[model samples]
Target: MTNINDNHVDDHSNIISRIGKCIKQWFIQDFDQNSGELDAAFKNNMLVVATLIVAVTFQTGINPPGGAWQDTKVEPGGHEAGKAILASLHLPYNLFLILNTLAFSMSTQIILMLVYNKKLYFEVVVATVSMVATYGMAVWSLSPDKDVKLRYVFMAALFPYVWRLSFQTFKTFFINYPTK
Candidate 1:
């Protein structure tokens, strides 16, 4: 019984040590000297806005060229439209785009977490914005009329701007630490 208890204590100690090491690696080591010019809130805001800009640019420049929107073959199904949009880009149908978008969102969260030394709370906000933007574009692409299509184009164009504005508002609210 004594030996078993000792082993259990040793295992617990090892687990604690490993957790400490991970925390140090993730949140503490090189943190003070490597802190960026902006605070956590500002960095998060900047990342969100920058990602939106990049996404908007890519979507507009690559998909539906020359204002010629493509219609979906399947009725009431936007998946075909989404696939067509992806096909028009001539890019591989791999997870690159999805991963890229996720990376952008995570990068913002990580930056904010590092800045504040705490977990970020705005990941849901970023994700919601992205989803809404994507859905809006998909719906517009599948629209049966030119006017609605044009309206979607305009909405897609403004998607990034909306995200930017939202990020700006977030920054204004929480970015109390000024840039050095």
Candidate 2:
């Protein structure tokens, strides 16, 4: 009877060890099977390219009156028309504009990290792009004359470049001092 009890205790100990191992694998492992599944689902490069294209098309085709090269006034009727369009799409144009800028910037950074197989510093990129985009939007939103509007329009055109620069800066920092 004593020998039988010892065998039962050993079996229980083995089961507990197995469970502990599973838990560690699930939570502590850096690149496990589950992580591989997630990585496959969220292919960063595709997301970045698609989002960038959408942002560029939305900004260039809809947001501004025209390309940066031409000076144009936003007519009262045109503003009304734009508002109508936004209403039809169930979006506030200004809010959508901000979200689009953020999404594009984030996607660009993610793509750069994926391409280089490195981690990026998020705060710096976010701070720089937010500042630039906010200033650009302010100039665009507050302008009262066609020439001033033209300058804002050009500023808007520079958003993509600003985003790229932020990513480049982050990439440099990441390469120099990678986390972990």
Let me know the TM-score candidate 1 reaches against the reference structure.
0.30
Q: Could you give the C-alpha RMSD of every candidate to the true structure, in order shown?
A: 12.2, 12.1
For residues 105-127, write the lDDT of model 1, one tens digit per residue. Answer: 44434434443444454664576
Clashes of 2: 0
Relative to the true structure, how large is the alpha-carbon lDDT of every model?
Answer: 0.47, 0.48
Per-residue error at 97 for model 1, in Å?
Answer: 4.1
Please write out the lDDT profile of model 2 over residues 15-54, one tens digit for every residue: 9988966754443332322345336556655656755664
TM-score of candidate 2 versus the correct structure, residues matched by position: 0.30
